[model samples]
Target chain A: MSLAPWRSRLTLALERNPQLNARYLQLATVGADNRPANRTVVFRGFYVDTDKLKFVVDARSQKITQIEQHPWAETCWYFPESREQFRISGCLTLVIANYPDLALQQARQDTWQELSDAARLQYTWPDPGQPKADAAAFESLPPNPKEPLPHFCLLLLQPVQVDHLELRGEPQNRWIYCRNDVNDWSTQAINP
Target chain B: MSLAPWRSRLTLALERNPQLNARYLQLATVGADNRPANRTVVFRGFYVDTDKLKFVVDARSQKITQIEQHPWAETCWYFPESREQFRISGCLTLVIANYPDLALQQARQDTWQELSDAARLQYTWPDPGQPKADAAAFESLPPNPKEPLPHFCLLLLQPVQVDHLELRGEPQNRWIYCRNDVNDWSTQAINP
Candidate 1:
């Protein structure tokens, strides 16, 4: 991933919404026969150095299966006030514990703090990732304390294409930016 | 469709926000490959007598194709002040003009006025409903004084499920209402 193009895209998105890093982003993955599945997760943080982005996922959600099937995904960040939207389509990678870092934990906590109590409860109990109480499956499973710990997994996305759509008046303004392997940005103006 | 369940879902959505009928809804549709495609359309008044909703759309958009191929689509309306969002997944209908209504035009014009001049100038032109160019597109096209007059097309939706997600604090709250029959509404709780 080229840092130049991503830096520009992230700068605009973050400038318009410094709080967006704390907002939830809806990640979509392709499903059977062209169908798509979506799930909203809090934004973990972005790594400008590695040109990567991270989010937590429960080990059991069907979304995990969808993500694993198709690593390519698109995310939408909708902002109401600015009537601005930032969309990116890219590839994802699941980060393992070998990536443990204090900085990443702090970033995760910052994003997590933005959620509501009920939202937190979804990840608070013995199993943070899956739907509550799978009686049929639970009866056959062994007792495991870490089961409820969300099996918290980190998913990273490296954006390949970014589009910024801003609504001001009649002819909406849109800027499309693409990143090349050489770490440069090519921009174009398209009719909105 | 079962009116009871549909109506219940609609009621839950409307009750959570009395202004839903007046607010703008952004519908996101994707191609068979799950690429992102979106358009801003109004929440054309819902049917009080039936489990249906309406919106004005240009036939040119790819959204029509996606909806035609796969009836399942999601619509989202975000309210920043309340830190709440309302989403629905449902089947769509291409409403013929024979449906008969005067408020339809009024609703469409009202929605248009909400758009900025640039957006209007760039994307919208006096509707001939046919493939006619904008003032600019027309100028580029050969002078043809004999083109057909513009027309408006209406799209309708029959919702199957509705989810209301409100973010209050550390956790979020969500309410799910499913349409069972014409007038039946089945309500359930889901993790936020």
Candidate 2:
């Protein structure tokens, strides 16, 4: 229940960079055929007070299948304003209908409720990565705000290793934090 | 060689975002134990007008080992000024001393000569990702700028798939360009 050592630095980054796009980060996963797949994913904030980072993905997205095959992922976030980067290596847990965790299932629902109407409607659109639909088909009707569609998934990234690099420094300050099996994190400053 | 379809958009992004950090991108790769690893890397530009994207890395970096194990990588670049994202997924080719490509070896030498003095000095410093060295040890002596050090490498990413997403649109615009084995590219407009 203790705070992650990098938490304060991440907090500082968020406070210093107020741009909405600052919340967007890159999520990289191993896809089918073991190809490295990456895309821009919105950072949905930490899961409660835990180190787990929250993100939402449509069940129909290729990332869902990629996660199913290989859950290991790395999230690279850069705050342009602060010129800092954070790369968190972790496994992603997709909260789907049959997923076992009831608490997480509830969290999924809560996350859905918190989404903007435009964002929620995206889940109602035709599946991503598919051939383009008609322009009219792109305009989707707003779905119910209180509940998530079956395909909407709350993805949680459980960080096992965190790398923070500050680009503003003389030689660029870099630190790596690794979590033990018991969840204790040890931090080390390394050459940038 | 013909240009990739996404090239123009990427060019426009660079033109609009004149910040030095605009060239910084995230490179994700499968590392030791099949875990995902990622970090920020500088984009060094195209290789002789080919589709390959260039980057530089030290031989002492962990990425070199990871590339030896799994060449697959994804480069995710976001242009905050233009609100555009480019994700290039491809396998990396390390142009080392023993690499067979003569042109690339020369390209490596050319790229080495183009680096700033400070950037070139980084390779002379203590190995990255290693335990923190003494402050005095951190100040490394400059190497010959005309020639790259033994461990300096030119990493080329031969992009097989290029995903360009424009976040400025209301629904966002995404296009994925895929290359066939013959190097012919086919593009698709997919739902964002």
Candidate 3:
């Protein structure tokens, strides 16, 4: 896929913000009760050769259920050094076991192989969002790097709209990019 | 309104992160189309002696319409210095002209007065989220501090639940604080 217009801008922002936290972003989803739920999630990089952004989430996490129910979500990412913000709204695709896409399954396995042993160990510890357990309960052996556990799922967001804001300008600058049904992206500069 | 269980932690976080961006947060709301909409907004301090967090919004902005349709929203704040994150979920209250509460009207005016002249002039600019206009259209004069424009609104969030996560700990830390109908808050540590 050719690089999206907004994607290039985001790449520049990421390049300018060299801090590690630049990969951290806030993801929002509609909960089962219809209340808005949000949390910080790390960007696992773009899905291999695709425009879809990749993130890792435990299938046992609360957000898994939220995504199953509503499917729609948004991510807000801010680059402090660049003083820019990107709000991308899209549908979340959770790649769980038996996800049906063989390529994505291979991608998930590759993503698991890329994680550090410490991160992979946490997935074997306990169910997330559950009541805190004793410290001894977290001493599980590290999982194999080649094979991710059943619950270690890849969360992909295929963006449909992007609202980017640059806060360092005199009056500031804002742009909205919308992808139509035919997958054509149209952008407009708007009042900030 | 007494201090919520999660409020004290957030207070400490703010004190630790002395940077200007500490007050900026990502707010997420369900849009008119049922898709999640997220944006970065400055935290304009709390309402007069109440737990309701106050924020200013351009009534002409798209979020105003989104919030009008779906009042629920969540604010995700990350403190880099403390390595902590707070996801506060709640219902939104918009105080516009002809609002019933006299006290809130006073609070809204007080909030308007706190903005810088440059910020105040933005309320006089053309509609937000609209197509690009000529550069001269944004040269509107600043409004009176004592009397805010009709579209200058106070957006308040009365939190119902807070998910606080600290990424500094060995296994990390997470707590969920929920407020019941009677306004009492209960907190529980969760697996992170």
Candidate 4:
């Protein structure tokens, strides 16, 4: 990866302790009706070589369907202590646990296994966004099977644009980094 | 306004102290390319009569342009302390300071005047999202004029759908309230 100065700065920001503003990332995706939807998704990791942000999701989630219909999405991350905001726009790709690519499939399995049993139970629930019969029914549902759920998938977001806003300055500082067709990044300082 | 049980619950949540979770609200709007964009916007107020969520914004902001292109938007707000999330989808309407309606215009003036001088100075800055020269140039710029900047706008989001999720439940509880053709809200329990 030919890291530009801004890219290096972003890398360092992400490398900071996850406890310090790296874990919770807000994801935005276009719904079926062409409206925008926003939700909080835990940040799994970032791949510097591919310039992709990774997260885990249940395959049956509404966001997964929205992403399939419209791959274009954005993520907004705010670090309250630093008073900095990062807005990232990109295309999303879903890698199923049983993908054809051996390396990717192994990576998905490793991620799934790394999750706590309680977290993995989320995928075992009924269809999301569907009407439920009763609150008690949730407890009576069958237990999760021994193997990993088939509905677990890894989502990778490859960013096309990254806008960083730092509110510490007198008038605030906004910077935009855009990736060119040749995979090189160009940076500019924009008005806040 | 015929308040449903869920609607009452939402109103109570918002009425809580601003220090709790009523101050910051996440806004989602579609970009020019039909991609979703998410950011945090302060919650100025909620209009029960009109069923609108009100906030302030700079008229020159990219979100204003995006709203003009596609008014459909959604806002997701989470209260970590309460473990509650409110997902609201709606159409946006911008009420300029010099609006035709006398009451609204007066309200706009009052809101603008109530803002601290430092807060109102944001509207006097150069166009947002545009490239800037240097950090020092911001300090050298002229002071904000006595009059309210024309770029200051009151944004009202009229909700068509409201989803409330409470994570305190064993399996979590999700309820969706959708507005029908006649402007009446119908509530349903959705699987979490």
Cα error, residue A72 of model 1, in Å, equals 3.1
* DockQ by candidate, in order: 0.15, 0.74, 0.78, 0.68
Worst 10 residues of 1 chain A by lDDT: A139-148
Candidate 2, residues A34-108, lDDT tens digits: the string is 777877899999998798999999899888889998999998998889999999988889999756988998899
What DockQ was computed for model 4?
Answer: 0.68
Highest TM-score against the true fold, candidate: 3
Measured with C-alpha atoms, the lDDT of residue B116 in candidate 1 is 45
- Tens-place lDDT per residue, model 1, B12-88, is 64566665332665565556766644444567567545656776665555566677676665666655445666666
Candidate 1: where are CA atoms >4 Å away? Answer: A1-10, A18-22, A96-122, A126-150, A179-185, B1-26, B34-42, B95-152, B169-172, B180-184
Candidate achieving higher TM-score, 1 or 2: 2
Q: Write the per-residue lDDT of candidate 4 for residues B39-82, one digit (tens) a residue.
A: 87887766536678788889888888898899888888766556
Fnat for each predicted structure, in order: 0.04, 0.77, 0.82, 0.82
Residue runs of model 3 more than 4 Å from their true location after superposition: none
Question: Second chain TM-score per prediction?
Answer: 0.62, 0.96, 0.97, 0.85
Q: How big an interface RMSD has model 2?
A: 1.4
- Which of 2 and 3 is the better model by DockQ? 3
Model 3 reaches what TM-score against the true structure? 0.97
Q: Against the hidden reference, what TM-scores do the models get?
A: 0.67, 0.96, 0.97, 0.89
